[model samples]
Target: MRTVPVAEAKAHFSELLKAVEAGEEIVITRRGRAVARLCSQRPLTAAEVLAPLWHEPLDIEAPEDRAPEPVAEWDD
Candidate 1:
């Protein structure tokens, strides 16, 4: 990870792209505050993006087992 000011980023755009291609993430900062990240663009299709959220409703039902019998005590 590396931080570069907006001016530097604009001046060395190709170098930044090369750095990103080499697996380095560059952060663009404005006034020493990080505002954006530069890295490889991985665009996913809408279906690919939302596929993980598609699932049947999880209908969890309570068990039907009978309750335990009450305890019996005998007094002599």
Candidate 2:
């Protein structure tokens, strides 16, 4: 982890991003107070994105169990 002033961060944005990509965390400070953090974000797989809902019960009904919708008649 590292702390950098906002102005310094802006001056070396590309370098900071490269460091973050290499798994380093950076904290940006404004007037000596921490304002933001920069960290690498990896793409999530479909399975990973749906993992939280995997164990939850779904209330969806099968197509065969659904009521049939009425057909409308058209006049020529």
Candidate 3:
């Protein structure tokens, strides 16, 4: 990830577009606070979004069951 000040990004808009096309993410900031990002595209699914940094084991243990809590009714 890379950061570019808002003014710099505005002045070098073409360069920023090229960087984004080359798969380099850029964050635009205003007053030292991040305001936007330049990236390829959005993930299609929740799994896609989480897949890059998460892993699942093929075999896993099941948790023990606990007693169910009683349901309560609410009245207005």
Candidate 4:
């Protein structure tokens, strides 16, 4: 965790966000008093961001079986 004056926070806002993304917590202070806290809004791994965790199995009914018939040549 880190404490920074409001002015500094404002000046380095981008850097602050980058730090937060890197897992660093930040405290914004005003007049030496804690006013706000900053942390990663959403932390996710690459796999999580890429796809859903659960996928429903596909449902396909099998075709009905039929009795085999002799070939037409058998009649000849």
Provide the clashing-pair count of each candidate structure. Answer: 0, 0, 0, 0
Report residue 41 deviation for candidate 4 (angstroms). 1.9
Error of 3 at 5 (Å): 0.7
What are the runs in model 1 whose C-alpha is more than 4 Å off?
Answer: 42-76
Q: List the candidates' TM-scores in order.
A: 0.53, 0.55, 0.54, 0.54
Off by over 4 Å in 3: 42-76
Model 3 lDDT, full chain set:
0.82
Q: Write the per-residue lDDT of candidate 4 for residues 1-76, one digit (tens) a residue.
A: 7999999999999999999887777999999999999987887567544445447644679999999987765554
Colliding pairs, model 3: none
Residue 45 miss distance in model 1 (angstroms): 20
Residue-level lDDT tens digits of model 3 in 1-76: 8899999999999999987776667999999999999886743466544556666644668999999999999898
71 Cα displacement, candidate 4 (Å): 75
What TM-score does prediction 4 earn? 0.54
lDDT of 2 by residue, 4-67 (tens): 9999999999999999887677999999999999987975567655666678766786666768
C-alpha lDDT of residue 49 in model 1: 50
Cα-based lDDT for every prediction: 0.84, 0.86, 0.82, 0.85
Candidate 1 residues 27-68, lDDT tens each? 999999999999767654676556567796456899999989
Q: Which ten contiguous residues of candidate 2 have the minimum total lDDT?
A: 43-52
